[model samples]
Target: MSLSFERTQSVGIIGGGPGGYEAALAAAQLGAEVTLVERAGVGGSAVITDVVPSKSLIATADSAVAISEASDLGVQLFATSDVGRPLAPQIAINLAAVNRRLLSLAGQQSDDLRGQLVDAGVRIISGHGRLDGERAIVASTGPGGTDFDRIEADTIVVAVGASPRELPTARPDGERILTWTQLYDMKALPDHLIVVGSGVTGAEFASAYMNLGAQVTLISSRERVLPGEDRDAAAVIEKVFTRGGMTVLSTSRADSVVRDGDGVLVTLSDGRTVSGSHCLLAVGSIPNTKDLGLEDAGVQLTDSGHIQVNRVARTSVPNIYAAGDCTTFVPLASVASMQGRTAVFHALGDTVIPLEQRRIAANIFTAPEIATVGHSEQDLEDGTVRGFVHKLPLSANARAKMMGVRDGFVKIIASEGSGTVIGGVIVAPKASELIYPIAIAVERRLTVDQLSRVFAVFPSLTASITDVARAMHIVGSDDES
Candidate 1:
C-alpha cells in the first residue's frame, strides 16, 4: 500500500526525545492524527538523565562554590578551633536529598510535557517502535516472544535519541564503573572519582563531583581539558580545576579499566594506571540507529551509525524523516525541536527553512558556564568565514568585581569588512543566559556599532557587552590604519 497523508491520515513519531515530542505537537497542530511511540519516558536521554539532571547537579555545585567566596561579602566563618575536629564547612549537602530532588524535577518536567501532548490530542504508546516496512511500524510490548502489534501511518519520524557510548574495555557495571546516565541513582558519594575523557561531559562530571566534596582525577587524551571548546576558556577552567584540588592528567589515554577489590583502576595507553574509588566513562554518544529497519526501508545512515538526513530532516525515502541525536546534526535539545518542526513544515509543503547551524547557540553548564554563538577562530582559519576577534575580561566588569569573580572573559568576532557580528563566546558565571543576546546579534548579522548603541546597565556584568563593543572601535581603527 502506498503512503499518503490525507487530512485524516495518521503520522507516527518514534522516540520521545525533544525532537519526537516537538514533532508530534507540530503535526497535531497541523490537524494530522498523530501517534507517538516511546520506549523510554517522554523526556528522552537529555531531559531524563543527561541535560536536566546534570544541570541541576551543577546548580548545587555552584552553591557550594559560592560559600567559599561569601567571605568577601562581609560574611564571616569561624572554623572549629578544637583539636581533632573537622575544619570543613559546617553546612553539608545531603546527597540523598539532592538526588531525590533532581529526579523529582526531571520527572515533573517530563510529566508536564506529556500532559501538553495529551491535551493536544496525540496518542502516546509505551513500546519499542521499529519500522516493519515502508509506512508501517511494528511495536512490541513486554519482553521477547510477544506478538508485534502493527501501527500504520502515512509519515514516520525517527527521533530515537543516542545513548552513552561505552569503551569496550571499560564497560559500565552500573556500580564501580558507571555511565553519566547512572550517576543520578547514586545516594552515597564516592571517596575518589576518576573520570575518563576530558570532553564537555567528562569535564562537567569531574567538576560537579569535585565540588560536591569528592576527590576527583580527570584524565584527558588531549593537551588540556575541554579540548573541543575555546582554547582560552579551556585554559581558565583547567587552572580553576587544578586550584580547587582536582588532579588533571593530560595527554593520557585509558587503554582499559578494571575493577579491583575496593576501587577501579584505569590503565593508560602508556602503561600507567590510575586508581580511584569509582570511574566514570564520558567518551561521547552514539546514535540509536540500529535495528529500526533503516537499511531495509531505504534510509541512508552515516559511517558513524547516525541516520543520514538532509537539512529539512528528510531521509533517503521520501515518506521517511529523522531528527535528534539519532541523526548527524548536533544533538542538542534546541536543535532537535527546530529540526522536528522544520521536518513537519517541509513535509506539509509549508514554508520551511533549512537548518542554519551558524545561528544556533550552545552552552556548557559547568560551574562557570561556557556559551558560544556563531563562528569560532578555527572557523575563520578553516576559510569558512573571515572575522575580527576582540576579548573583554570580566574582571574589569563592575558586577564581576562586586561578585568577587576574577576569572572568565567574553570574546566577540565580527566580519572584518562588514563589522557584522558573526560569532561570540562568553565564559562567566551565567554565560548560558548571557549568550542569548549575542546569539540574536549573530542571527540578525547586527553590526558591532549597533550592538554598542544598546544601553547596558552600569555596574552589571552586561556592561561587559559594551566593553567588547568599545574594543571593536580600536579594532576598526587598526584595520583602517
Candidate 2:
C-alpha cells in the first residue's frame, strides 16, 4: 500500500543529530507535520563534537603537512642566510584559535541546518524529549524535568546519538584525561599525547596530532591499529604513523589513566606504564537510549543498550523508529541520515528499500584515508564469500609519483562467476573521494568490464581504480579460457 504524498501525518523526532533532523525534513517533504526535540545543539554530536570538529582539526594538520612539503616541490618557502644555511622558519599552533574556529564552524553548520528545518515548516523544541506513552512525546523544558509539552504524533523517530565510552579506571575529566569532544576545547596542545584505543577515532586523532607537531603514543589493544579495517590499509597507516615519529604500541591495553602532577600516566594491562602530557580515551561509544521510557513504549533495546530496529528503522513498537549511532553498529553520519530517511518513508507508508550494509562505504579520516565498500578480504579468507580480487599499488600511478605518494593501494573484488563488481578498498590520500565510484558499482551491481570501460582522467588517482577494474576483468577472462 502506497501512502499519498499529500496525506498529512504527524512525526515527532527525538534528538537533532543527522538521523533526527534528516527524518524531520524527510517527513515534512512527505507533507507530514514534523516536530524535532533536542536538548543540546541541533546538529548532534556529528557536527558539534564528533565528525565536524575532528575533520576540521585534521584539515589544519593536513595544511601543515602541505606547507612542510612545499620546499620539495621547488616552491620557495624559506630564505637562505648569507652563509648558505636556510633560516629557521617558526611554525606554531595556537590551540585556542584553532578550537575557536572549530567551534564556530560547528555552530555555523548547526545554525544553517536549523534554519533549513525551520524554513521547511518543521517545529523545533528545545528540551529533552522522550516517549510519554505509545504515541505521545513529552519534552521536559528544564533540568528539573518539571515543565513539559506533550505532542501526539503518528510516528516517532529516536535518533539520540551515542556518547564516548569511558573506562572505570580512566574516566575523562575533560582536562588532562579527555574524550574526543573535550579535545576541541583544549587551550594548549599536549607536549606528549597518549591516545588509548586503535580504532578509527584513535588512529585519526593520533595522525592529526602527530602532523600538528606533537609527540604521540598510540596504544592498540588488538594486534594492529584498525583491526576491523582492511589489513593492507591498516599496515600502510601503521607504517605512516611509525615514520611520523608516533609510538605505535600494538597488543597493549591501558588499565588506567591517572594524572601525575603536570602530566598523565597510562598504566598498561601488563603493569608497564607510559607517561604523557595528556591521554585521550577513544575506546568506543555507548548508545544514549536510557531514560527515554522506550521499554514502557514497547520498544525493544539490544543488550548493548542500542534500540533494536529492523533495516527500515522500525522498532518493536509499530509507531516508534530508531536511527543513527544509537541504533546502528556502523556509526557513520551518512548511514545515520539514510536510516532516518528510510524510517520516515516507511512510517508514512511510502515505498522504500531497506538499508543494505554491504553497499555502505566507510572511510577513516586519517592523513592517508582508508575507504572500503561491500565485501572485505576477510570475508573471502573466511570462506564466507567467493570472489576474485585484483590489487594495484598507487605507487605505480603517475599522479601518485607526481605527488610523492608511494604508500597505499586500491583493491577490487568481483563475483567469481558473473564478474560483477562486489567490493573494493582504497588506501591513499583522498581515498574517501575515490571510494564512491566503487560504492556505486557495488550498489548497481555493475560488471567489471563496465567499470573498466568508464573513462577516468589520465594521470589521476581515479585512474588506478579503472586499472584495478581492468585487471580484474582480464583475470576473469583468463579463467574462462
Candidate 3:
C-alpha cells in the first residue's frame, strides 16, 4: 500500500529549531513545497547553544562522577588532581573543539533534515523570514543586508524559537555577566560561577559547573530552587546540589551584576553582594516574536510576547500556525517537536490530533535527573483535579543500595477512588528514562493495580516503580494522601 499527498501547497517555516525543522520535514514528507528560512544556523538556540551543548557538558561531567564511583564497586581508580596547576595557561575545555563537534553534529542533523526535505522537493533558504503581509514572507540575509525576496505560501509554520532574556538593570555584556547562550563561546572555565535564577536552566548549570570543578553559587529568587517544579522533587535536587558543594542563595534575587577588576560581583535585592569569577543569568527566556511582524500580521501574542496558539498549533490568523518556545506552551524540545508535527498535520487538512498536556513529560537534568508527567503537586493547589499522591523512597529499594545511591524518591498521583495514574515524579539516576513507564500509564489511564502487576526485575533500579505502585495500594487502603 502507498500514500499520496498533494504537491501543489507551499509551506514556509521560519525557524531551524526542533519545532521549525521538524515541521519542514513533516510538511515536505506530506508533499508540500517546503521552504525553511533560518537567520542563524539550523537547530536554532535549543540545539546550537541551550539544550545540546549543556546536555553534552553534563554528559562529560557525569562521566567524571561515574569514574569516581568505580571505587565504590571495590575497583580502584586514580588520576592526578588538575588543581594547583597554574591558571596562566588557562587549561579547560577547548571551545574550538567543542564548538567544532557541536556544530558538526548540528550540521549533520541539519544536513540530514535538509536532505530529507530536498528529497521531497523542499527549498532551503538561509535568511531571516518575516511576514511581508498575510500569505507572504520577505527574506533577507541578516538584520539589515537585503536582496529582498518575497515568497508566497499557502501555509506557514512560525517556529522562531526564543532567546535569553536580559534584565533591565543587569544586562549581559556577553563576557562577565553572561546569558546561557553565551556559554558555548568560552574556552576557559570560571574559577567561581554565580548563577542567578535557580530555575531548571540555572540549577542545571550551577550543578554542571560544580561537577566541572568550579565553585558555583546558585541565587534563587524563590524560597527554593526550581520554583516551577514539583516541591518535593525540587527539594531533593536542592539537597543534592548543596551536598555537592554548591552554595544556594534562596529567596535572593540578583539586583545587578558588574565586573569588579578580575571578578564579577552580583548584588542582591537584599543589599548584599556576592563575588564570583563569572555570572550566568538563567532567569528565563523570551520568545523571538518581536521582529516577525506578529502584530502587523494579526497574530495574537500573550503579555509576555509569546504567540497564542491552539493545541493543533493554529494561531488566531487562519492559514498561519506557531509552535515551539515562541508559542504559549511550556517549552520543551519534545513538546516543540510534537507541536511542529501537529502544526504541519493541521496545515495540510490532515487528521490532526489536538495536543494533550497530560500526556507530556518533562525532565530537569540535575545530579539525579528529575522527570515529571501529568498533574503535579502544584496542580492540586489550584483545585484542577481531585486526586491522591503516593510517594516511594529510592533508599528503600535494594538497587539503590547496590548502586550506592541516596537522596531521591518517586511520587505518584492518581485519582482518589479510581486509582488511575494521573501524574508521577522520579528523582534518581536515569529518572528521565524510568518516568516513561509511569507516563505511559498516565496517558493510557492505567490503574495502580495494573502497574503493580507489571514485571520489574528484582534488585533492579526500575523495580522502584512496582514498589511505588504497591505503596499506592497501601495509601489507598489507609485513605491517606
Candidate 4:
C-alpha cells in the first residue's frame, strides 16, 4: 500500500532559493507534483549573488593572507631588484578577474541546482510569482512583462528571500555605496571601504577585504562587532580587525552616506565624518513579503513583514508553509533548506521532525570563523538548564602551536547534574567545520563523559573538542578527583 493519497499531492513553491528549491525536491521525492516559480534563476540570490560569490571572494582573500603568512611557515617569496638588492614581493588581488571568477562560480552553482531540480521532475517557471488566495499561484511570465501563468496546487510554499535593508538617507548607487549583492559588480577593490553595521555580514566583508589588501574601516553601532554572537568570539574578531590595520569605530552609528567628489563620505550620528572610496550597508534585510497577497490570503506575517512560521514551517493556513530568510526563523541557508524539507514532510504526512533552535548550528564566515550550537553562556546564565562552562584556548593545542595559531579558544557548556553537552563555541580557522560533532552532541543530548569517549584524531583542531569534553567531565565529577 502506498502512503500517497488517491490523488497525487501538488506542491507549488514561490522563489527558487535554498528553501523553495529544497521544498520542490522534497515534495517531488514524496511523489507529489511540484511546480517552482522563481523570479531570478534557480538557487536564488544565495547562489546568484550572496553566499557563493561572497565565499569565493573570501577564498581569494584567504589565499592572499596565506601568501603573506607563508614566510612564517618557511615558505619565502623573493623578488630581484634592479640594483641586485632583495625585495619582498607584494600580494595584489586581481579584483576584476576575481569578480569574474566568483560570478562564474556562482553561475555554475545556479546551473547545477537547476539541473538537479529538473532531474527531480520539478516544473520550473521563470517569472515573478504570488499567491492567488490560499491554494493557487499566479506568475507573470514572458518578456512583455504582462503574460501570466496561473498554477494551482494542494500545498503552497513561500520562500521569497529577503533584500538588504536600505536607509533612505544612504541610498546605494552601486558605485560609491553598495549592498552585499552589489559587491560583485566592483571591477576593482576600493582604495578605502567603509562598512556600516557590525553584524556578521559586515564583519565578514571587512575581514575579507582587509585581508585582500584593501583598507577597511568598520563602523559599529554596538560596542562590539557581531552583536548577538558569542561575546568572546566577537572580541577575537575585533582584536583581529584592529591588529590587521582595519579601523574599528565602535559605538559609532552611521547616519547617512553620500558621494563626496571621488570618494564617499559617511556622516555619523555624532556629527563626525569618515570618507572612503566606497561604502557598504550591511545593516539588515527586509523580507520580500510585500504585494505577494500573503495578508489577503490570511497567511500571517510579523510587523516587520517576516512570515510567521511554526516549528515545521507551517503558516496560519494549514496548507500554506513558509521558509528561509523570509520566515521568522534562523536566517541561515542551512536552516532554510531544512525548513523546506520539514514543510513538505509535514504536508505529505511523512515522518516529520520539528526544528529546534537549540539544535541549530550557526557560523560567522570571518577569519578565525565563529561557530556555535545549542545553549550559549547567555542562554545558561539565567535559563532552566543547570550547566557550567569549560573553556580551552586553542593556543594550548599542539596542532595550533605547530601551525603557529594563537588567537582562538574552544568553549563548551554542559549540564552540571547530567553532564550533558548543552552548547559549544569554537573560535578558530574553519570553526564552521569544527563545530559539527558538538552540534551532534547537543542534538543527541550526549553527556560530556560520553562525548569524551569519542576518539578525535591527534594533532588536529577537533582534538580540542574532546579535550574540552574530558575537562568538563572531570569538572562535573567529584569521585574522579
Candidate 5:
C-alpha cells in the first residue's frame, strides 16, 4: 500500500496583520497551497501604524527624558552662545522629522514582509476580502475595484484587525480631534493635548505628550487611572503623571467635543468644560469583523461583533479559524501570531499546543513601563484563584540607585502552598524586557527555588528578579508568595 495525495492542503487567510502574515508563512512552509488577501500593503497596522510608529515615538520621548535624567547624575549639557559663553540648552523635538522617519521605517518593514511572503511561495492578493461561504474567499482586486478573485481552500483563517472606536458625540475630524492612527500627520506637537479615557491607550499617549513638553489633561470616568491594573502600579503611574505636570480629571466624563475656533472644546457630563489645542479619543476599539460574511458561513460572533474562537483558534465553523483583534482573545500581537500558528497546525495534523492566558505577557508602554505575566493579584480577589503576593520596590535595587531611579517595583505571585511561580509584575523603564523570564517560569511551571537557582548578571535590573524570587522562596513549605 502507498500513501499519497492528489492535491496539497490549501489555506486562505484574510488580512495581512501579524496573525494573517504568520499563518500564511506557516501554512506555506508546511507545503500547503496558501493564499493571503490583504487590503493594506503588508505587515498590517501593527507594524505600519500602531506598534511600530507608536513605539518609535515613545523612543523619542524616552530620549528627551534621558536629557533631564542625565543632570541628576552630574552630567551637564550646555550650548555655546555666539560669543562663546555657556548657555542653558533648549530641548526641542522635530516632530515632522520624527514622523517622517518612523513612517519610512514602517513602510520599509511592510515591503520586507511582502518580500518574505513572496519568497515563501504564498500568493498575496492586494484587495478587500470576505468569506464566500465556508470553503472559499472572495477578494476585490485591482485599482478599479471591479476585478474579483476567489480562492477555494481546505481551511480558512480570518485575521482582520480592529479599528479605534469612535463616538458620535466626539467625532474625529482628523485635524483637531483625531484617532491614534492619524497622530503621525502632525508637523508640530499640540500646545495642549486633551486625552479622553484612562485606559492603556489613553495613559500611554498622555504620558508621551506630557514628557514631550505638551500640556496634557487626562479625563477618566473611573475614580483612578488604569482602573483594572494592579492598584499599587496604578498609584505609581498616577504619581508620576502628576509629577510630570499632567492634569488627571478622574471621575469625570466628556459629554461632547466640538471645534472651538482653531482649537477644541470638550463639554463634560458635570456641566464643566475643558479646552485644548487637540483631543484624542482613546476609549476602545471595535473589531473589523463586520460585513465579512461570518454569520452567513455559520461563524459565531460576540454581541460586540468579535469572532469567537477556541484555544486553538477554531471558530464555530469547523474549517474556519480567526486570530488577532478580530478574535475574542487577549488582543496582543504576539498572542495573535501564536493563535494563527496553532490554527494551521491543528488543521494540518501537526502537533498543536493550545493557548493559555496564564503564560501570556502583557505590557503598557508608559514612561515607566508596566509589564505583567500569568495570574495577577486581582485574580485572587475575584475568588477564581488562590495566591499570595510579594512586592519589592525598585528603589531598593542597587542598579536602580546607581541609575537615579525613584519609581516602580517588582511584584511576585505564587501558588499558595507549592511556591510555583504563578505570575509577576515589573514597573520600570524597559519593564517589557524584564517580564519575559517570569513568563517563561509561568509557562514551564517553575518553582520559586528553581528560578532562584538561575544566575542573573550582578548590578543589573534583572538581578532584582532573582533577588525577589529568592526572597519569595519557601523554606519547608511555610512561606513565600
Candidate 6:
C-alpha cells in the first residue's frame, strides 16, 4: 500500500524523542500536517534524562580526571595556605553545582529541539498520548485530567521510548536507593556507591562515579562487565576500573537492595551482603508500551513488550508505525532518529532505506570510552560470518603516548577474501569520536586496502584506525603473494 499525497495528510506522533521528533520533522517536510505528543520535554530521555544528562555528568568527571593528571604534564597545583606546616593539593567536587549544570544543559537542549520542531511547522502537544484506534490518538492533558484532545491522522507513529526496569526485589525510593535518573538530585557525591548490573549503563556510571572520587563497587552477574561488548574492550575497561580503585564483583548477582539506616545494603543471591552509602540500579530498560491501547488497535508486540516492526518501521496495522526504544532492540538515539525518518518516508510514499542494525555505531561513555560498529569477534567465533581480525593497541599510537593513555586498543574485522571492513571496535579516551571513520568504512563496504589509503592526521588517535587497516591490507597481500 502506498500513501496518496494528492491531499495533505495529518501525521500524529506519540512521543517527542529522537524518533518522534525526527518523524514529525520528516512528515512536515513531506507536506504533512504533524502533531507531536510528548508527556515530558521535547527530545525525550536522550535530551532530558538518560543520554544527555548521563553524558554531561561523565564530561564533568572527565574534567576532574584531567585536572588530577595536570601535574604529570608539568603543571603543578599547590596548596597556597601555610601555617602549621605544608598543605596538599586536592580535588574537590561540588556535586550540587555539577548536577545543576547537567540538568540546565539538558533543559537547554530540549528547548532548542522544541524550537526547531516548531520552526518546522510541527504542532507540539504536552500530554500522555495513546492510540485511540488505528488512525486516531487521544491525549490526556493537565492536572484535572478532564480535558482531552482527540487527534485524527492518516498515519500514526509511536516512539514513547523506554524506562529503567525495576527489579521486583528492589525498587527505587529516589534516595539512598536510586535509578540512574535520580542521581542528579543528590546534594553531595556518594561516599561509597554500589552499582548493580554490568551492562553499558552500569559500567559508564561506575566509571564516572569512580573518576568523580566515589568508592565504587560494580556487581556483575556475568563473568565480566559489558558481556555484550567486545571481549578485549571489556577486559581493558575492567582493568582500568580495577586499577582506579573500583571493586568489581564478577559472577555475582544482586537479589535485592534494602535501606539500612543511613546507607543501603545489597544482598546477593549467594546470601552475601554489600553495604554502600548509595546504590544505583542500571539493570536494564522496559518498553513504555503499557496502557497505550496498542493491542486494542491491532499493534503486535514482542513477548518482551516491544512493538514488533518491519525494517521500514511499519507495525501490524498498515497506518501505524513504531520506532526507537519502543520497537528497536538496539536503543541508540542515532538509530532511533534514523528509524523515525524511515517510518515517515515510508508513510509519506517517499523512497526509504531500511535501518541496518549491524551498521549502527554505539558507544559506552566510560572514562576511556568503548565504541563499536558492524560485526564483532563473538559473531566471528559463533560462525555467524567469516572475517579476519587485526588489533592495534592505543599505547602504540603517538597521540595516546602524548596523552599518557596506555589502556585500550582498536580492533578491525575484515572479510577473508575481499578484505572489506565489516566491523570494528575502539577502546580509548574519546573513542566515541574515533569510531565514525570505521562506521563509514563498514557502511560503505570499504576494503581494508582502500581504508588504509585514506590519509589520517599524524599524532592523532585516528591514526590507530588507519594503522589497523594497513596491517590488515599487508596481511591480505602476504596471503595473495
Candidate 1 is scored at a TM of 0.94
Model 1 lDDT tens row, 43-143: 78878988888899999989988886787888867667568564656657788889899989999988998999999999998889999877988887777
Between candidates 3 and 6, the one scoring higher on TM-score is 6
lDDT of each structure? 0.87, 0.91, 0.84, 0.93, 0.92, 0.92
Clashes of each: 0, 0, 0, 0, 0, 0
**Over 4 Å off in model 2, which ranges?**
1-7, 79-86, 474-481
TM-score of each: 0.94, 0.96, 0.92, 0.97, 0.97, 0.97
**Worst ten in a row by lDDT for model 5:** 1-10
lDDT per residue as tens, model 3, 294-358 = 88989899999999999999999998999899999869998999999899888887778899999
lDDT of 6 by residue, 1-481 (tens): 3355678899999999999999998998888999999999999988999999999999999999999988777787776565754466899999999999999999999999999999999999999999998999999998965679999999999999999999988889999999988999999999999999999999999999999999999999999999998999999999999999999999999999999999999999999999999999999999999999999999999988999998999999999999899895578898889889999999888999887778899999997999999999888999998988999999899988898887989999998888989999999888889999999999988888888888899989998888999888745353322
CA shift at 55, candidate 5, in angstroms? Answer: 0.7
On TM-score, the stronger of 2 and 3 is 2
Candidate 4 differs from the real structure by a C-alpha RMSD in angstroms, to one decimal, of 2.0
Model 4, residue 463: distance off in Å is 0.8
Best by lDDT: 4
Model 5 lDDT per residue over 1-481, tens place: 1112477989999999999999998898788989999998788999998988998898889999999779899999998989999998889988899899999999999999999999999999999999999999999988877899999989999999999999989999999999999999999999999999999999999999998889999999999999978898999999999999999999999999999999999999999999999999999999999999999999999999999999999999999999999999999999999998899888887889999988999999998999999999999888778878888899999999999989999998988888899999999999999999899989988888778888898799888888888998788753333
Query: Ten-residue segment with the worst summed lDDT in candidate 3?
Result: 84-93
Model 4 lDDT per residue over 211-326, tens place: 99999999999999988888888899999999999999999999999999989999999999999999999999999999999999999999999999999999999999999999
Candidate 3 vs candidate 4, lDDT winner: 4
Q: What lDDT does model 2 reach?
A: 0.91
Q: List the residue pairs that clash in candidate 4.
A: none
Candidates 1 and 3, the one with greater TM-score: 1
